[model samples]
Target chain A: MAKKPELDDFRVPFFDDKGKPAKFSPGEFDPGAKPFSSGTKEGDRERLAVIGALLDGLQERLHAQRVRRVLLVLQGMDTSGKDGTIRAVFREVDPLGLRIVPFKAPTPVEAAHDFLWRVHAQAPAAGELTIFNRSHYEDVLVPAVLGDIDADECARRYRHIREFEALLADSGTTLIKCMLHISKDEQKKRLQARIDDPTKHWKFDVADLDARKLWDKYQNAYQDALAATSTDYAPWYVIPADSKTHRNLMIAELLLRAFEGLKLEFPPAKDSLKGLKIE
Target chain B: MAKKPELDDFRVPFFDDKGKPAKFSPGEFDPGAKPFSSGTKEGDRERLAVIGALLDGLQERLHAQRVRRVLLVLQGMDTSGKDGTIRAVFREVDPLGLRIVPFKAPTPVEAAHDFLWRVHAQAPAAGELTIFNRSHYEDVLVPAVLGDIDADECARRYRHIREFEALLADSGTTLIKCMLHISKDEQKKRLQARIDDPTKHWKFDVADLDARKLWDKYQNAYQDALAATSTDYAPWYVIPADSKTHRNLMIAELLLRAFEGLKLEFPPAKDSLKGLKIE
Candidate 1:
């Protein structure tokens, strides 16, 4: 039997694709890596089915245990397959125990309160699985690069988020953050596809290009934020997201490993039910 | 081509295996209708798959329209298949566009504010779909029967809910509310199943029994709530949910009908990308 791999062993292929060592300084890093191919061969469908069955079992165990909630945060650039990864991995799980919260721009009420207020309300209850499509990390990544807020405020939020997640961990929530790292070329292709296909044109936002222009700055912010915040309790997993299949599999594997480590047990049946007549 | 079925022709079934009909007002009603089994055969997986495809198509159309929002409100008794319907119908949807918000007991913050505050915060954005596993109907149903609030308060909330939904409709958000109806015996069987199966024991909440004792009161509350709130803009679809398969298909068909009415047009692509270079 193969030994279980450590969480750190999860490969992030961005640096290798650039043919140079990637640096994480207080400044920008040039974009690297091509789109990762989803290794969906002919038999891949069968494998996914098997994985789906396993997921059902895992979900049951998690619910039965009534343990701490599990929060899976997926962050990525456009077309990074955040949506696709979530659907494929969690497709078989029971909806009762699963919660998906996608954070968009702050509304008037949300803007009035702290940035984390809306997010806090959406956290999962016990024995549930919550997925955040884009999370509080945006306070650091987007605002820092867009100059929407000052650098000092961004730095302050980075510290606040680390503490916020640590508190959730202490309160029985397992936070697993995944950054779907896609390449610039892949993003361009996807954006073009959205424009070319009338059915997909609604997904294309012209404003996203403004962020693309400052992509290097955003990369620096992400690197700084990850380094500052990834803790033993709530670590970041940077998946090679260029390939939708690979990203989905990697996420599923990460989740499987997390649940496996929790050692969840099913609650025993109440004996009183034996007297109840089903007929 | 088959003729379109009349809305009145949709009759849901109920059952009285344990002779529990004596507990409620006397009326000649089919207790063993099992209305959910209409289009699908017994024990067929295709029912769920077909619903899943319809949900996926609806999601795609909803997204392509750039219509930021859609809301699915599910209200049901125990074993009414709220969880099953949501899972089966939305199993294949893009998670980015979907958000499932389950309303439970009020938290400290929720209690501090008005009831609608928390719910309004979770409303879907443009190009998104939001599901309320249980929702603001509690403001009327629980209070009306339990007398936690007076009749005037309940009546006021009924009007408020209608106005709220109307506001959502006017804002271009499609609101779909479903009430899952199940017989008392079916509820008992489902509750018993939760207690009998060790794997499902965790879902057996003691509070559920308290609600079961007030089953008739709840039915009355539901009838009143639906009658008062169902509007042309956001009509209620009271689905027969005794069979999980039937509930899934019916809900999916309703969703398909809703999306089909949108007549979503994809945005035209700009030719400006012709000069963009990918190095």
Candidate 2:
């Protein structure tokens, strides 16, 4: 029998200590692969539900302890499943403890400050779980692909991202980042489907299609950003996202492992309240 | 044939044009009433699912039109189901279109500013749906009930809230406020349940019982605040919340009616993109 698949196999290698540019390519992984699925849709969904329940309990314990934080960063292209992944994986968790921040185009105020300023303000506090939909990685990916920043400048931003993540890690936060990977062919189908339906027209803008024209550039930018920023304190995983069920399950499995690794426990019982009665 | 229970019947009478306060009291409503239920738990759930689906579509149109906003404010005493109502009513809506804000005891920085400052910063933008788990109403209820502010001061703060809500309404935002009403006996049972379970201890505070001792005062403060602030643009509804399903269903029904009244439509098709194909 083939060896059981491991999550680390998909992790971008840790950045080299010598400050050399690390090399990796998005094209090396097939988007259609389902390395973590249970071989059937029903089975995959059942597995996801199981993981969701465990996540709910773990999140409760995290909140009860009130001493640790968890941050999950999701980055993907337009047609990838960042929103779907958040809805599916967190369906069972209490909304009180889960904070979802969707970062869009920078406003004038945000653009005035250093790129990390707005992001730092939203860092998860103790006993909270935060999900960043399309995070600061966009800073590196967009400017580089548009030729607004040179290679050295992009590398410098990558280092800043690594250091910022390290700051969060040092402050009792566990960070997990994923780049949802999808094929160009899948992009064509999604865009075509939206265009064929008039109801979906609002989600489309003519300028939105301009990104597909620069697909290869964006992919290469992602490759450089992932290779340079993946570190010991914060790691990036490439999620194969062509199969929606498989994508949800793999991400769910990854998160459950990260949370369980925290070994979260509820705060100890209070001795003074052993026999306390409500008046 | 029996008459239907119009949601408007439970609405706090709109503030009079002369600004005379209404004389209604929270004690007039029964916590165990289910005026909106379909007479069985399963029936109420089915009704809720129907309303949830309609709400999902209305929210999509609200986002597409990008012209109007919806804000739902939920305030209740301990264990009266503010969090539960949000989780249930929004279970089917796309998370992309919804934002949930939970206000806790103000921090030093927040308390430094005027009460409405932090709240104004979170008002819903055009084409969005926002929910406040607890809201500005707390400023009146908690302070007045605790004797931290005199009745006259509480009334003055109520006027400030009315003005602030009018500002939002003038900017094309629709506001719906619900006060979850539960009996003191129900609250006692719920608090006792939390105390009995060690796992739920973190959610309990010794100071919580002190508030229970002042339940009648809180009820009176709620009565005064609701009568003073309810208006044509922003109305307050009393929700009988002892039955969780009934509370969820009734709120879902009320929200659907408010959303449908807006008559939202998707933006017109762009003639420039008529039949354009992506490269």
Provide the TM-score for each candidate, comma-separated.
0.78, 0.97
Clashes of 1: 9
Q: Pick the candidate with the highest TM-score.
A: 2
Model 1: residues with Cα > 4 Å off, grouped in runs: A1-7, A11-45, A60-66, A104-124, A143-161, A210-221, A268-279, B1-5, B11-31, B34-48, B66-69, B105-126, B147-160, B271-279
How far out, in Å, is residue B234 in model 2? Answer: 0.8
Q: What C-alpha RMSD separates each model from the true structure?
A: 6.8, 1.4
Candidate 1 local lDDT, B117-175, one digit each (tens): 88888878787888998999876788788879886787678778877887888888888
- Report chain A TM-scores, every model: 0.85, 0.98
lDDT of 1 by residue, A1-279 (tens): 966544465423222222332334422222232122234443444556567677678777776676768899988776778778877887767665667777888889888999888888988778788889898887678877777888678767867887788789998998888888777777878776766565554565566678777777877777777766667788776776666666666677778778777877787766655455443
Per-residue CA lDDT of model 2 for B158-272, tens digit only, reads: 8899999999999999999999999998887887787788877888778777778999898988999999989999999999999999999999999999998999888877765
What is the Å distance of residue A171 in model 1 from its true position?
Answer: 2.7
Q: Report the error of model 1 at residue A107, Å.
A: 5.7
lDDT of 1: 0.70
